[model samples]
Target: MPDTTLSNCVRDAATQAAGLPRRRSVPVSLIAAVAALGGLLFGYDTGIISAALLFIGDTFALDDTVKQIVTAAIVAGALVGCLAAGP
Candidate 1:
């Protein structure tokens, strides 16, 4: 019963999405591209620590807890970057 209702909702949403006119799609495309680029930047920033973490720890001679703290700081910076950029 729930599955049927869910399927109907999905079908309705798909129909609505498909029925929309795309004549003024350039703005939409630009928005999507910007959003995707933001994601890429976020991914790049997040992944950078993977390459530099050992160097960061070794350079700083950090312990396990400190290493976790350093790694978490990168994620925190990403969050701050996103917040600064805003939605």
Candidate 2:
């Protein structure tokens, strides 16, 4: 339960709703364009990672510990990205 109520969201007189965000949505074309770009980037990244990991694993002859290190590094990078974008 929230102890403090959020009041930053204000409804205009035109709408009867209060204490809630107004219903809003981005345009479908804009949303679809962003989604398409994100999907493309995701596919490209996964493909690159698959190829890179083969060389990376062989170069390190990675033990479980080293594999963990690589995984942790990627996780840390994602966390930093989230922190940068968060409110």
Question: What C-alpha lDDT values do all the predictions have?
Answer: 0.80, 0.68
TM-scores, one per candidate? 0.63, 0.47
Q: Which candidate is the best by TM-score?
A: 1
lDDT of 1 by residue, 3-76 (tens): 46886777767778899532447898999999899889878976887778879788888788987887888889
Off by over 4 Å in 1: 1-24
Q: Any residue pairs clashing in model 1, and if so which?
A: none
Per-residue lDDT over 4-36 for candidate 2, one digit per residue giving the tens place of the 0 to 100 score: 434422334335554545566679778898989
Best by lDDT: 1
Model 1: how far residue 75 lies from native, Å: 1.7
